[model samples]
Target: MNTSPSPSGAHHVEEGASVRLGALVPLTRPGWVEAGRHLLAGLDLAVTEVNDAGGIGGRPLELVVRDTAADPERAAAAVDDLAGLGVAAVVGEYHSVVARSAAARADALGVPYLCSSAVLDALTEQPTEWVARLAPAQSHGWRIYADFLLGAGRHRIAVVTQPSVYWASGTRILRDHLAARGGTVVELDANELTPEALCDALVDHGATALLLLVGQPEPAVPIVRAVRSDRRLAELLVGAPAGQPEFAEWAAVLGADGAGIPFLRYLPEHLGPLGERVGKELRARLGEAPSFVAFEGWDAVTVLADVLRSHGTDRAAIAGAWPDVAVEGTRGTIRFSRTPGIGVRQWAWPPVQVVDRDPTDADRFRILRTG
Candidate 1:
């Protein structure tokens, strides 16, 4: 029996007999550690419930977690390590850069990968049969935001995008969708200037709204504060297509400045019966409501467990079963799309909401739009 120590720093008692699953998460990174904690909570809950139900094929399921630390190289190495350890499948990742790196490794190793929350369009663009994504691609989310902006009469929009491959790709989609709808877009690189300068540019261009494509909270928090503090851009509607899962945590730092700032979130306040039960369990464990990332992690494990139960623990069997695996998750029906133009093996229907930060309560953000 293999006696290697798991990433959680514990030895698996049923080492060789158990079905091992790799969980890649950012555990120690400054911006992503909190998200990782929440996601891990959901994964733990799912694993417990699955094990309680007699596991898959009467074999216990074990999670071998590896910290990505939000770094691409570290993520790639983690995938290689998981593959070397003979994990049946791998899941749980948040950063798009890390997901891209880990996906490449999973494809190279022929290990089935279920991406949890990474949203870059290019991550699923390639024809990799072993890789499938749970979250909707950035292109899909951007289109929804574009439609909302146009419908809300925000014809003149300014976009501030961070210098990341994920944000850059989303910006292209956002630009195309806005142009197709006859909306004017002024694009600015968030890395090119300070947040104060970016706000000045928005004011000069007479922008009706500002769309932020930064995927993390560190940069987003400061930008929102800068825009809200500036009198010239005080009325400008600022929104982010990413980082909604960390809205409450980041909003706590921004205080009043974060109020009314809109963001795209996947988890709504009202979950269905099953989801409500999961939420209560998570709250009891984590002392707060489960975030969207947490739900994504839980759903990833749930889908993987279902595949394992139906198709044994073989990698090829799991990959083959993914195309037909249809399960109801927290966000609604979970199914992958092979449809052209969006992305291959990507989730098409992820319930997303444009929520505004509540002025009084940082924990309870108000939903502005849902789709």
Candidate 2:
């Protein structure tokens, strides 16, 4: 997991060694750990392929790793360690809050930060050349959900979100979009999330569809369990798969969704060449499904590698190439603006729905609409 500490001033690449790429990712639980493993595998494969074809600017590549763990304090310290190693730039997997905290540290230290999975608007609302995202912001995903569900007869929507900014504000964008489509937000957070309290909110508001913006399994698991507990109120429950894998550990409990599709941009079990091959390689090394977060780790490395390879110790050339490069990611095309606050210019891989046990194939998630 690359958890060791780096010596001070080690951020600079060796005198004539290939340029180095740095990545920060969460190695611990409740989200994207397995899939992340596979993602890194695919990314390494991409890097190797790039180098084998012919070195960029006649230099090889070095990829470094840092564990961001999901702790704000630890994440802050992590960027410092990475900076000391003279990393060219970074991309990582974690929450937008961590991205925000770490990016500030990275920027001040003169290291650019590009996020691959963290997707909250607050993470990138102010323009900065050193920070950017490879993932789309929350509102974009929410809008897609709102447009499709409302058109498909999901009226009287109830937005069950936690107090987190990721859920509270971003989900509101979906709420506003839905209201514009003639779908009323029947219920908001409704404060107290007790079973009795939730029932009262649903009963009083008469919500027909439920939009879940909650991440972490604590409240999310309970909310889903509560929804499942009352069969009388079953309705559409949906959100990104990145946040649901935590719930997968206790699948028996979270699997309660018999009537909804947990959205996922990339599904590891069903993978392409780079993904399938790398998944196996990572398992051989990491001994797991390669948390999807690993891909964020891997992509961060490859992107930095490709970016730096073009620069060859020229940080400016490296930084400039970042804003408009696109790669065919497992989810879809991954592209971004090197500038920050633009959020990720990328869009979600076309939404894939779980229909009749056939998500293993691409035909499953039909495109009813686009947000």
Q: Which ten residues in a row have the lowest lDDT in candidate 1?
A: 1-10
- The TM-score obtained by model 2 is 0.76
Residue-level lDDT of model 1, residues 178-227, one tens digit each, is 89888888888878869989988998899989887774575677788788
Looking at candidate 2, what is the lDDT of residue 23?
62
Top candidate on lDDT is: 1
Model 2 C-alpha lDDT per residue in residues 102-196, reported as the tens digit of each score:
76665555566777667676664445455656665665555655666666676787776666666666666766887777878754563557755
Model 1 TM-score is: 0.91
Off by over 4 Å in 1: 1-16, 215-217
Give lDDT per model, in order: 0.79, 0.56
* Model 2, position 210: C-alpha lDDT score: 65
Angstrom error at residue 253, model 2: 4.6
At residue 228, candidate 2 shows an lDDT of 70
